[model samples]
Target chain A: MSDGLSILLSDVDVGPRRHPFLRVDHLQAAAGECVGIIGPNGAGKTTLLKLCCGLIRPNRGTVLLDDRPVGGWRGWRGWQGRRIGYIPQQTEYNSHLPFSLRDVVAMGRNALKPALRPLDGADFEAVDHWIAEMGLHDRRHQTFRSLSGGQQQKALIARAMVAAPRLVVLDEPAANLDTRSRWQLRDIMERLFRDRAMTVLLVSHDVEFLPGACERLLLLRRGRIETDGPRDEVLASPSAADVLAEI
Target chain B: MMDAYFIPILIAGAFAGLSIGLLSVFIVGMRMPFIGSCISHAAMVGAVYASLFQVNPTLGALVLSILAAAGVAFIHPHRRHFDANTGQAILLAFMMGLVFLAVALEEGSRTEMLGLLWGSILFADWGTVVVTGGLAVLLVAFVIAFEKELKAVLFSRSLAAVTSAATEPVYLAFLCFCGLILAVNLKAVGGLLIFSLLVCPAAAAYQVCRGYRSVLLAATGFGAMATTLGFLGSYVFNLPTGACTVIVGTLIFGACSLVRRALAISE
Candidate 1:
């Protein structure tokens, strides 16, 4: 755990009923660190990410952002939307809904007050910036459901980023993406990491796509971190490989 | 003469058709037809209670319906296992109260309570036309103004929240509105038949359309058609117009189902 870190998990235990899915004794990602969480399929990486965003609460221990305990604030949803942007592994759109790409991206701004205060020129400029940044400027008006898997993923990322949160968490952002799209996503994420002051916490089973720019690595096995250190050290560890085998 | 009373009755029937028809689309899309039916039946009890107490039946029904709607909405998100059972219990309590009050009232008490128990389009008047018209217009306007928000919430509650939309207040207002409309229209359709009006057309529309906007429009059309056709049938065959209206609605639903199947098989 780095002293300058903005996020910390202290003995966070999440489980189903009597079985603990994952346990985080102590883990931290420094301010503006591009952290990657890699582990076996059932190692609870997703659960850990969810806990950080306050989407799910741990049975014990505390999750802290910038050293402030997440649940310590009573209004967690408001806090989450404002500071943390989360992109889930998979999104299932209700076929009945008709939402455009712009609509989807705009959802990232849910934390903003809705008292007849319309999105003005500055907001439109921000939306356009994200649209072009993700290379979805032309597809902004298309219905989200009509897009391909890779395109949808890009749009989802754009949606999350448009909120301009301090921390962005993405779970397997390249899972179903084509080779070319995956590379493009990696490049986009790298650019965002380098240019924007956005701290990224990415969880991926695919080792090939872990961005070269990642600042730290945490590998989980059976709900506990197997290796936690600088990216190369953790990725090269035997225990981390064992965690990968199970993933 | 048919000219004197028939026109007003026909107009009332049309109003009934439009209000329930439009609302049913929301019910079907949200998968809450049973909830709607339960509210309608509970509202009937409120109407009877109002009539028995010598107060405005509309006011009584509104209060009761709002309370019932709130109870269900609050419990629905928190307690799925007990929601249906609890709703049934509420319906039963209100029904029993209505029946008991009816029995205890004076034999000659001239509130014409039975009229509400089994409503008639034949009883439709200028007042019924006005109230139903106002409600129908409001329902259509609200649905259009908040279409995206409505679809978001109806499709998936968590998904809706994840989106930029502020879904809590909209969801609350939706439940309350459902109860309010059911209470208001109880005077036209009665408690028993209200469920049919609220569900049949929308269910039929779901069979025909994948697009939500189309589904709502189709459901509204189905409802209006049923009311008009039902009124004509009742007039010609001398059957109860309300019952006939429900019968027509069911037939329309059946026809739509058959058409959907035929299209599927051909494709």
Candidate 2:
């Protein structure tokens, strides 16, 4: 009911077959809220994240972003800029592709600007800031596939954040990262939420990787949200231990 | 050192080489080198049908190639029954079958039919030169104009779709461009040899280049070099022009691979 809600999903069903693969009756995220989505494998966490970002539409339901329907927002050019940011579970980059760390990060700015236009000074500055923030300045010129797993994750994070989006959706971003990188990722998410009031939807099977700023928790089970409430309440619930065990 | 006849041949070869070389980077980069093969065979089917109907082979080739490319695009990547690559393969086989049928049905001189199959770059006319040159220029201009969009799609199509709304249109346009280039150059390179020209140069460049722009430049340079050298070799050895060109391209790719191996060992 809040006018400041960043995302709203109502009666959503996704996937083929007589029985939908994933269904969400109702879900809402207010502006500046960091919602951690934790679920076991096959619980449709990634699908829920994709639905939020309009990468996959629901078979039946209305999804809204900032008071506008996602279908309409999808029509706008550079919709990711200042609106939605998504870092998929897999980066989907080809090893043969000659994209460098800087090039990957620059794509964020290019997504905002018109095609064929070169990056201006402000764009470069923003890119530099994110690269430095992600501690990737040393490897900025290296081919993306040449970097370590942690470095690649950081670069993808920088790419997702470079546009200063209103909502950031990350699907299992820390899955392949090491312990140090996972902690660093949590720190980055916390900083972004604290300093910029950036709304975040972090999907992960690992609960420890969730940022400290994540106040809301949604536990997905078999394509449905079995528990949705404040992080502490969800954690203290009787089924929380079972969910942790399932993961 | 070029003679009057050799000059037109070289020019046509260069135009087709440059255009195909540049586009090949995308084909190879996207890991869909078979797309070139698919579109070229579709063009071949078009040319055969045109010959049977007494129509413009170039127009027929373009139309059929576009339809084939679009068909590949229409197949969903997540289809349970048929994937995009499988769909392309089916289309290619169907087109190739139709081409042979059309050739068999024709009662005229088989020389023309063989020309479509094997190509005759040595006998290229002013018309071939003009069409190839115009298409080369158009392809170059398109790459320049949509460089970012193309890069985005090349990097990742689904990611590009999420970032920019122009991904689908740009992707379809890219496929259409592939069809156009294949159709226009069908006579010079022949359907059978065009795939090698479209992939070998780019694959060779990819072996050495560390950046995307460098790969594009190197691929185009390698394609032109191979085509010219192959033409000279064909002229001196009295061999098929298309076969000679493809052989040169394969040699370049093999040499580049060896160089890459040597560099990797030294490092």
Residue pairs with colliding backbones in model 2 are: none
Question: Tens digit of lDDT per residue, candidate 2, span A135-177?
Answer: 8898888888788777877887788778777777888988877
lDDT, candidate 2, residue A66? Answer: 75
Runs of candidate 2 exceeding 4 Å displacement: A1-5, A71-82, B74-83, B107-110, B265-267
Which candidate has the highest TM-score of all?
2
Error at A218, model 1, angstroms: 3.6
For each candidate in the order shown, give its overall lDDT on alpha carbons: 0.73, 0.81
Candidate 1: chain B TM-score equals 0.88
Per-residue error for B122 in candidate 2, Å, reads 3.4
Over the stretch B1-267, how does candidate 1's per-residue lDDT look in tens digits? Answer: 467768877877787787788888767666556668667766777777777777898788888877777766655332242545456566656665765576467366544566666676766788878877887888888777666566656654544544433555566677788788888777767777878988899888877765567778888889888888998998899987779889999999999999999898220
- Model 1: share of native contacts present? 0.11
Candidate 1 structure, TM-score to reference: 0.71
lDDT of 2 at A49: 81
How well does each candidate reproduce the native contacts, as fnat? 0.11, 0.34
